[model samples]
Target: MTAAEAAADLAGGIIRPLFRSGLLVEAKGDASPVTEADRAAERALRAFLTERFPTHGIMGEEYGTERGDAEYLWVLDPIDGTRAFLTGRPLFGTLIGLLHKGQPVLGLIDQPVTRERWIGVAGQPTRFTSPMGGTAACRPCASLATAELSCTSPDIFDAAGTARFDRVRQAARRVTWGGDCYAYGLIALGLVDAVVEGTLKPWDWAALVPVIEGAGGRMTDWQGQALTLHSKGEVIAVGDAALLPEIVSLLS
Candidate 1:
């Protein structure tokens, strides 16, 4: 928790001001959009983790890996929903996660613009803050037929993956798009029922596991396997654990 808090503090502080600043965005080699906000926030996070946990490793979206030999590593995404951030949607999130020996044990999702946060610890219920400064929890969803689903965008997925996700979306009662990391937090808050996403990295989904599970939900790969630091990144977050088998079948 301490590790993620520090990173979130530094990154959130740097990112909030840049939200709708018309900052120039540059594309990475993968054609993904990046901005000064992403770079600056990640830099702040890496610096704090280096100073506070020198023995730990670090991997971030803007910065590459460091100290991979360490037993613990910090995975970060200073801004998880850059597309939304660019459009001034306030739907972007700052993600921070801790992996002990390659297993994610802690995670946080912070939306600085609204001052909303969801902290997920390995063995504890998720903690949340709303704009009004009060507690929040996920409501129960008895079945997928009444479930609401989300994805950052169907466009992020490849042809095969999109088809699989479409099946799940059709199975669910409703679907919404373009939320990124905020969608996972919504699931934790019981505002959304499930989130199925593909082609994610460790920094993208690692922190999400604890938050979803701790909120009386479940998170795993689409195959229904546990997510490790090395998982293939086809993720499924569902408030109702019983939906897994049927959802996985659709995705499969």
Candidate 2:
């Protein structure tokens, strides 16, 4: 199987079981909640990657980092929203991305509870598959004039995030709250027009980038900067090209 396919299968196999069994949850040093499920999921994914692509490097949230100078690296976020997952919300997901020469080339966000998977490659069309065997071709929103906007938390920005949030809210025709990584997944699915967030970690934003761009959306730092693995954690994603300039200008 291709790397992307293997990653997706690994994610599914890991998350599906914990989500079904209702595992116990706990917290990490950052105060972010974690569960046995989260660790198990990451371990499974790491083991799969190590065995299948032994030459590749790996970075994961729970286990810290492992290095391999090979041309390819795998980045994993076993459970993107442990807070939501612990609460039994279906918004949580498994995020996996492949970095080729330091640039993400493929990404997968699998919502095991929802049985929804959003998969894409850097230059490919984003595709969505549901548990019912239904599939859809996705693209970024085509119209800025009547676009919808979303974000993870209204509080990510502090004063700056609030200001940027206000600008986006004022510019968009509508705004919906409450979706973490799931918001970006919606953007990839062409269901949401844009998403703005702040104070994210690499694992938080890396996987979403390829999926969003592959779906024909634009993702950048708040200042309209290119998103790198070392970005400042602020992010803006838009489906409409025209809307981005306006959003950026207003945030500035």
Candidate 3:
């Protein structure tokens, strides 16, 4: 937790100043956006982690990998939602995750602009605090018909994935879009019931597992299997565990 907190502090310090400053945005080979804040925050985080745990492996969105074969690996996405940050939305966050032999065991989501943070450690309840005030608990919904659902964007889905996602969207009581990592945090706060997304990288969803599960929710692939480094990017997260089977069935 200390390491994750320090990483958040370092990343936030770099990110907060650049939001909406009209910084130059470049497109990566995949066409996703990148900015100086993302690169700088990640560089700072990598340096700290390297000094703090010299033998631990590190994988970052900005800078690829170092010591990838270590038993303890740190996964990072200094700015998880570059689009949101560029648009001056406080919904973007810094993600820091620790994987033990490829399984996530500790994670954090820090929204510096909103002063909101959520920490999740394996076998412990997720902790959350925000100046706006909310508890780190998920609300129960009797059925998908009553669930409030969110996805970062429908465009992330391919044709088949879109069909599957639409099945859940139609059954859900309401659907919200473009939440990015912030949507999963809402599930931890009991403000959102479920989120389904596709085309995610490990850094995109690794930290999310502990946060949601520690909040009495479940995070898994659409097939209902636990998420791991090797799993496909398709993901389904629900506040109510009972909802998992139904959601999996729908996606299947």
TM-scores for candidates 1 onward, in order: 0.96, 0.89, 0.99
lDDT of 2 by residue, 1-252 (tens): 276566667777767767646677666787787888778888988888899888888888989778746688788898898878777678888888888887878888888777788787888877777876544334445554578888776866788669757977887788888778898888766678888788887778778877787777778997888777778888888765556777777778
Q: C-alpha displacement of 177 in model 2, angstroms?
A: 1.7
Error of 1 at 104 (Å): 1.0
TM-score of the candidate numbered 1? Answer: 0.96
Q: Which candidate has the highest TM-score of all?
A: 3
**Candidate 3 C-alpha lDDT tens digits along 152-250:** 998999999999999999999999998789999999999899999999999999899999999999999999999888888999999999889989999
Residue 139 miss distance in model 3 (angstroms): 1.0
Instruction: List residue ranges in candidate 1 displaced over 4 A.
Output: none
Estimate the TM-score for candidate 3: 0.99
Clashing pairs in 2: 157-161
Clash totals in order: 0, 1, 0
Candidate 2: which stretches are off by over 4 Å?
20-22, 68-70, 132-145
**Alpha-carbon deviation at 145 in model 2, angstroms:** 5.7
Error of 2 at 77 (Å): 0.5
- Rank all candidate structures by their lDDT, best first, as comma-separated numbers: 3, 1, 2
Best by lDDT: 3
